[model samples]
Target: MSKTAELLKGAAEGFPDEVVTQATVRHLDLPGGAGRFALITLDNGFDHTKPTTFGPQSLTNLDAAIDQVAAEAEAGEIVGVGLTGKPFIFAVGADLKGVEVLKRREDALTIGIGGHEVFKRLSALPVPTFAYYNGAAMGGGVEVGLHCTYRTVSRSIAAFALPEVFLGLVPGWGGCTLLPNLIGADRAVTVIIENALNQNRMLSGPKVYELGIADAIFEAADFLEQSLVWTSAVLRGEIEVVRQDPDRGEAWDQAVARGRAIADEKVHGAAPAAYRALDIISQVRNGDLREGFAAEDQALADLIMGDELRSGLYAFNLVQRRAKRPVGAPDKSLARKVSKVGIVGAGLMASQLALLFVRRLEVPVVLTDIDQERVDKGVGWVHEQIDMQLLKGRINQDKANRLKAAVTGSLDKAEAFSDADFVIEAVFEEMGVKQQVFAELEAVVPEHAILATNTSSLSVTEMASKLKHPERVVGFHFFNPVAVLPLLEIVRAEQTDDASLATAFSVAKSLKKSAVLVKDAPAFVVNRILTRFMGAVLGAIDEGTPVEVADRALAPLGLPMSPVVLLDLVGPAVAHHVAGTLHKAFPDRFGTSENLGRVVEAGKRTLYVYDSGTPELDPEVAALFKVGDTVLTEEQVRARALEAIAEEIGLMLDEGVVAEAQDIDLCLITGAGWPFHLGGITPYLDREGISERVVGRRFLPVGTAGVPE
Candidate 1:
């Protein structure tokens, strides 16, 4: 046995639930009578839902299959070797369940080296190797193809990516070395760094071919047969494949520099994975694949043994598992079918909701406003958005027509909502206005219909307080730009029944959103936490701190946007309103910013101007601030902000705002776009000792989001 195989002998000891992927080999005659071929199919025994992953046992299986093919090639029995996956899934990557059980650096190093040793044999074989990416391929799946001499991808494959950096690890299994050598450094940086940081953006099949990663692309229906024929043609000298020489000059240095800038902007140097991958890619300009492989192995081991990777893995599990099966949600069987929907208020928010509902539920939706002009504008906006989708090829013409026709607008509430099963109001944030809307909606809609409110900060319980059928009222709060953000805070009022809440969850699932169950508190979960955080920065600015210093205080935490940018995105008026609401509820912890109110009063939508391609504080907005004599440094600002957050989270936990800390983290991650490296703030607080110092305890136990004690 090889050193790698020996090292991995007992690596699967603790992974009991790992679904071991198997590699089976078969012999097939070349389509054009070129020669015999050795074809290997990767399967995990389950359906496509259970994608093939590389674990210790799975890697061992593949290693054995490679040995068989290598021997056949040496014996001149097979002219070429081919690798493919089962059904709709090519492979996702390593089994994270296996990675989670690794306890020592040696084990982590062993896994990385074992993968390199096994996959390297494909390129070393005497016969030419081919990879048939028949379906979704990611991480190690993509790396395996990079080891082959040629690759063919199916046009129908939905996702392809090297997402290791996003998960707090480098693409260590020959990816960082082989990909840049195959496709040059610039494209490698895009697939390895830029795309990974952009929420792990995926590449289409055509994109893979366009990037020079694949030699050819074929339709999914007969992808295997066509790939076999193409391979036969290549072997018979009937088809010639040529590749452009990789650029190893100044362009390589420029690409690596761009990758560093992206990593700094995205993670603010808080995570080390992106920099590590960049280093490996930069060293590839010397054309020593072995040196690059060694760098990858060391980097992988270091990251695997660090807290950031563990925290990232924890966050990944939370998003993949907990977000799907939300805690405290009512039974799915209790949900009522929403056949017809009604939306109150004909504004931007309501129009977005109309489009989302009509597209996801495929049900007739009506929007009502007090004036015909507003109603016509709202309906026209929805139609325009549908046309845009059609133009982008996201939806067929028939589907776009159906969606546009399904959404209608009317001036009469009764005509719009008399038979509707679900009616959500996107009216003013005032409690009285929302209560009046719900009261009117209850009188018009069916008795079994649900009355939902999209109020961001108003009390859901108070909104339903004036309704006769309070049991049918629930809070269905969606983040801004409804089509983009995935979070939907499903708030349960004091009088909300199980049926209403269950139906809300069902609708959120249909919208492909991550729903977190929150109580009807002052500002719910995300807005409340964010208000406290932003309030700290604003308070610093009020005390004479520079706007630039206050805004960049939390740079070390790697938040998606700076505080000032976030304030601009959330709108000064909206932030002022929410802050006022929170201050009223908890005056000591949540402060109302006078400067923010001034900005809103001045009708300023943003605090910054960007005519120079970079954000600069707007002079008019800056001149409006009323400051005190005392100023705070950036560290002081960041500390105060985090301390305030820890305190507010403790209070929220005491008040049962959500079930636990994980729910708060989930809310911030999906709703506010917080970085995963911090595990949504609580873990960062715990690791930094802020949670214990401010909250008198840690939010999570040791080893949950930190190093094991």
Candidate 2:
């Protein structure tokens, strides 16, 4: 294929670099004029047979390659493209390594916008384009399909939707436009918004089509042959053009109507975005696509470029990019296999992490705390879960016992860490205590242990400072209830060796966690940014603003829970601890206030009259805000909360506590109860420019430092 005259060879132009081909589709006119198309393949420039990415030329080469094919094909044609491999992926999506090129702005073209633009150009092609997706189609790779006239999926494809909205932008390309146009608005919005929320909601071919995005599906075994048959049909003009239902997707329209009614009835005095998206869909339903596409395009473009999108996209990207796998001794092949894992603490976090690790990796694990009492409690938890699974018939007793046996509790650290290839210490969030445990483990365990600490707000490097084997200390910062939270920060201290980092990545993979590599800075990634989020809520309280108002104001902004409720779940002590850590590490920037300390001293939990696990904004909370009787109606309170949250998010980015604008959204979505339909906090701010407007009306002016007392 590479030797083809104007086909694959010419596709390499402009790319000038080595490329990864993730998609391949070829069309042919048979002897009797029977058009034929065959397997689309995906292949990397590098041999993962060895541990490396594409050769120096990079993924840009593949983009250049595909661009060439699109150029040759007429408008809307599923441009013919192929890779070295067959029947899997024709080409993988954007080479994230391209981010390296993006960082040095003056050195090369801006990566994100440039890649976005490329996808848009592909979308303009007029012929019926079909991507026979075999494997994964992520980021840029999926963007290409947005341009295509059609999409077919092989059962092998682990379909997903993403725009890195949590990374500080929406799908900057036309994806935001194309998706809503392809699917109906509600489903597309759900896909994009949920991608920002969890990042792990896997959508398959039938699912994608059910969501109204995909065009067809084929068998994985015969996917190569089927893809070609479909492509040949395109060449022969036998397939129907992709078209929307005349009712403009009424099924989706009805769902939206039903959802809106539910939202209004159950979640009163809530923000309107979720309902608004449905409204927008309903409005667009009566119109032709031209009107709908234009509206969605401009709205999405403006939204992605907004504060919420920027903050959210940045934060999400940051969280996902850090895959700190433990590849010790540099042998590469068998770096961080994490065959068996050991948990040092079986408290809630420890138990949570244990369940998640087992759920993710299906690997055997040993969970231990200081005493049999706590151990029994933790083991009891596993038993309860296993029993539930047994009752649910999700697993039989034999399997239940196997899984139950897979998780055991103990008081012996030496025994736990000995056979275990990796260990994570999720003890209390104290540096000295973590160090003491590591020291003890080092004395009793094997020399090649990969020690991980699940301290959210502590410094990874500082934690390593007290260790004899400093290189082994890595921060495996997991959010509360590790079983539930998806993001894992792999904090890399200055002393952290590549081997240790690789081990963390290995463990993360075994545990099926999204491991992001972060510098050993204050709060690592998620908490550093989240600390600012909590502070914003507190800041609103300090400015004589009512807590009830602050809480309700953000309700409509699409957060899962209000800021106060989130704080209670986080535990005021832990929240304060992380705040103090970030403040101490980067004083002036992450500085804390008497307000936070006062909360701790005054014995105030996040909200008043806590309603057990999930906090409800009760009367006591209203009293805390001085809302006498009905001073401010629920509607008024929610409006103010939105304003206060926007202000503090702005402060975080300005203060540099959050390195990327999207980091705010990532933290909010994962840790801070961010609502998916509302896309995350930063996106809301950006879409409305509410940040700018809020500051103008209520907040201190942009350049001004503090709010008026």
Candidate 3:
């Protein structure tokens, strides 16, 4: 046996069930005078829910299958080789579970080299080759198709991407070398870098063909038959496959520059994979295939043993596991059935709730307001959103019509809540207003009906105290732009019953969101942490730091958006409100800033406004602050912010806001857009020594962030 095969076999012996996919070979007769061909199908012996992924044994099986095809070709038994996947799935890529188990340098090197050696065999075969992309193909899955001579894709196939950089690794299995040379460097940078950074945006099969990646596209029902016929014609010289010559001029240089700029802006250069990917693509214009492959092998082995990859994998596992299984949720059987939903107001937030309930729950949702005009406006807004979805091809005509017909509005609270099993209020943030809405709802709603509030920072207990059945009240806080953000923070009040909490979790799951169970503390989890962090920033401004300097100081922390940008996106008025509420709840630790109050009073929307794409301090907003001689440097500003966050998080843990530190990490990662490589705030604190300095102890154990001993 070959050395690569031996290494893979030894590794597979340790985890026999880890490698999930197996390759099966079948002989097929071809048209157009081509005698016969050997077809290989990749399947994991599971339903489409478990997509095929490669591990040591999986790659070994594929390697042996390729060898059989090569032997058949040499014996004059086949004219070509065709590769495809089982129904509804191509492959996702390498098995991350397998990579997570590697602890030795030799094991990492063996896996990396084994993959390149096996996949490179596709190009070495002395026969015509084709890849039939039947469904989703990502990372190494897409790289395998690049090794083929031609390709055909299925109409039903979507979610095609090269997402290695997003996972904190480069495309190590020959993708870095082959993609840029096959498609021009400009297009390669987009597929490999820009799309990966944008949360791994994917392309449909037709889009794949339009990008010159596929030679033909066919319907899913007859995809294999069409691909076989096309391959036969190509072998018989009856059809031609045309490809665009890669552009290797100034265009390539400019594309590389653009890719670097995007990586720097998005990740602030914290991700090493982005720069390594750029390095690989830039070398492709002047390097040979073998040299590029060797470079990838080295890069993959190095990254697999790095702290960034370890932290990223930890974060990935947390999202995949903890987000699906909420920490303190009650049994699923305890959830009440929600047949109808009611909203207490007909404003923008209420209308957004209506759209979400009608679309996800597919049930009747009614909105109530004080007058007829506002009620009509809210209902009209819901219809407009449904129409927009129809126009964007997100929903069919039938779905759009059904969703639009399911929404209604009323001026009478009694009429809206008469039959609603779940009623939520998205009214003003004031406790008195929320109390009044819930009191009115309690008078009309059924005894079994749930009362929910979408308050960002108010106390759920106070809002429910005025209700006749406070046990039915639960906090269902959702972030703004409800359609995009995936987090649904479910707060359980002191009087909240298990039935109501279970139903809230069930509803969040049905909406396809990551649910986090939080205590009924002021601002709950995300807002409490965010408000404390923002307080430090505003405090620095109050101490005479430049508005721009204070805003730019957190860039090194690698937050998804800058503090200033986030404040603008979430309106100055909302931030100020939340800060004031948090300050009231925790007066000793959290403080409200006078400068932010001044800016809100001036009616300024943003502290810095864009002038020709450059952010300049809005003179009007800047004038709202009184400058003194107590300015701090960027390093000092960052230190102050980290210290504040550390202190607040320690208090949250002490108060048992959530179950564990992992819960806080999951909440921040999902709701607050904390970077994955940082492994949430606690891990970042542990690594930076800030947790020890401020709180006199580390937030996590040693080596939690894969810090070398």
After superposition, the stretches of candidate 1 with alpha carbons farther than 4 Å from their true spots are 13-17
Candidate models: Cα lDDT each: 0.91, 0.57, 0.86
Q: What is the lDDT of residue 516 in candidate 1?
A: 95
Higher-TM-score candidate among 1 and 2? 1
- Candidate 2's residue-wise lDDT over 274-325, tens digit each? 3434444555555443454454444444443233333343343445542233
Q: Using alpha carbons, what is the TM-score of model 1?
A: 0.98
**lDDT for position 247 in model 1:** 86
Q: Candidate 3 lDDT, tens digit per residue, 1-709?
A: 7776897887665343674789999998897668889999999898777879999888989999998999998898888888899888888888887776566666777777888888888888889889999988998889888888888999888789988887778888877899888878888888889998776779899888888888999999999999998888899888998787888899889999999998988889777888898998998887488888888888888887776776777777778898999999999999999999999899998899899999999999999998999999999999999999999998999999999999999888897789999999988889888888888889999999999999999989988887778999999998877877778899999999999999999999998888999888988888888888888888888888887888888888767888888888888899999998987888887887887888899888887789869777788887788867778888889998889999988888888888878888888887877877777788888888898999889878876656334
- Candidates 1 and 3: which is better by lDDT? 1
Best by lDDT: 1
Ranking by TM-score, best first? 1, 3, 2
CA error at residue 181 for candidate 2, angstroms: 7.8
TM-scores of all predicted structures: 0.98, 0.60, 0.96
- lDDT tens readout by residue for model 1, 535-557: 99999999999999999899988
Off by over 4 Å in 3: 7-17, 701-709
